[model samples]
Target: MGIGSWFGFGDKSARASEPQPEPAHTVPTSQDLLDAVDRVEQQAKDGKAPGMVQSRLGRVARTVRDTVPRLDTLGSGSPQAYNVMATATNYLPDAIGGYLRLPRQWADSRPVDRGKTPLMILIDQLDLLGATMDKVFDAVCRADAEALVVHGRFLEEKFGAAAGGGDLIIGSTPVPPMPATDPSGPSPLTPPPGRTA
Candidate 1:
């Protein structure tokens, strides 16, 4: 006010020189993915989609729910990760919303795509999403399964045979071998010197 407002010279220059705040780069969380799934499910329910559509939608949602916690296994910025996010946040919702926008009777009866009606098309889309989600879930699980296999192999290599000639080996410790017994010797189960059974 003292210098810039009076002269009108410093105000514009100072404002231009100041750094602007960057837009927030929002990273979706697992809960966000679950909430998206919930929204899509509720939409399908409220929209009164056919039984088949509801079933397929449930399949995709279930798989996405299972996979959300393991998305890190798919790696950040990877295609699988992106697909999971996109399916939850956009593709699934868009497909349902598009169908829902149409009047129910026309959507169910009219064949907009060749011989298939909108209902059929929506079912197909849901099936595709379901399969894709299944694959993504499998990929996430497979990462942990592979790690387990690798660890088993490592243990086998490091510890040699776990049971070699009936001798057990646990980690680095070797189980003590059974004492040798003479065929003619007194029964090993006999009571010791001072006691009799």
Candidate 2:
């Protein structure tokens, strides 16, 4: 709808004339991510990492640290292995950093405040990272290099959207089905005949 549009120039043309803002998060290379993990690990141990962030970073760091010995099993030549490693080290911890950057008032109130806040957004980012970690771990266990690579791309999609300032929702949890309990004394240890265990 700008004057450029009437002249047949697309938004891209108009955008090219404007200075772009620096990105909030820098996409990390493998080495950069590894170094960050090391720093974050030390930070966590030093008790300087913020409360919620500490555990998440520690978990990702530990998972990747344990996987280091088995990188060969995943294959050094496997891009997915590297992708998984980088994403875990990079994006996961970055969310923690994002939370730390928020003002204490905003960060503290976010937990009780009934609105979208920076802390809430960072939490959503962490949730995405945790899910990504699950996929990476599963792929590594299965020695599925391809899946790891794809998972890296998936992380980029989710994290990229967040970095791009898109809405991220943690949404409600769905209740899982539970088995009915019997008041009668212990049922047979084994399922009755003709029933699947």
Candidate 3:
């Protein structure tokens, strides 16, 4: 074995024996893609929170639907494109679920979000997912192999293995809790005193 081969970088025979992880590539069919998109749409409708969250989710859903056609487009139909789309889809449902879990009072208050409301944060996350879908769509539309590679690297850096499952922890920022409240009562969007315009 050469010096390179000595450090677990063995001969072809040894390398071949080692099990490799399946590539993140996904060869999703049109039906599969469409079905996944439908699920995301339903999730958007069902899980949408009140106020800004609803609007953001609506935009994200529309963007996802728009990106679906790119799957059947000439260049963007590659497995890599599907991989990115799939990852984005995976994140959507979980994100909506996270929003549903947070009380409106906490999610709406700006101080809890460090000057940004939870709705703003949620919108940013949806925007990121939509942007990725747009990139994948554009790459496919143009059949630009180089752009495909660039998109792939961005996914790799941004998500690592998480993109495969589309489960990035976007709501990691803490939202302050409200005072005691009735579970059935509506949570009010109240700005702290003296801060009100």
- Candidate with maximal lDDT: 1
Candidate 3 has what TM-score? 0.46
Against the true structure, candidate 1 reaches a TM-score of 0.72
Model 3 Cα lDDT, one tens digit per residue, 1-197:
67767687648787777799898966566666567656755665675566466666566566656666655554554664555566545677677767667876777675546688766777788778767766766666566576687898897888674333333454895554445677676546656567663
Best model per TM-score: 1
**lDDT for position 119 in model 3:** 67
Task: Give each model a TM-score.
Answer: 0.72, 0.45, 0.46
Q: Give the Cα lDDT of each candidate.
A: 0.89, 0.64, 0.64
- List ranges where model 2 is wrong by over 4 Å: 1-35, 44-50, 76-79, 110-114, 144-197
RMSD of 3: 26.0
Off by over 4 Å in 3: 1-28, 72-83, 110-113, 144-197
Q: Write the per-residue lDDT of candidate 1 for residues 33-110, one digit (tens) a residue.
A: 899999989999998988899999999999998889898888889788889999999999999999999999999999
Kindly indicate the candidate among 1 and 2 with the higher lDDT.
1
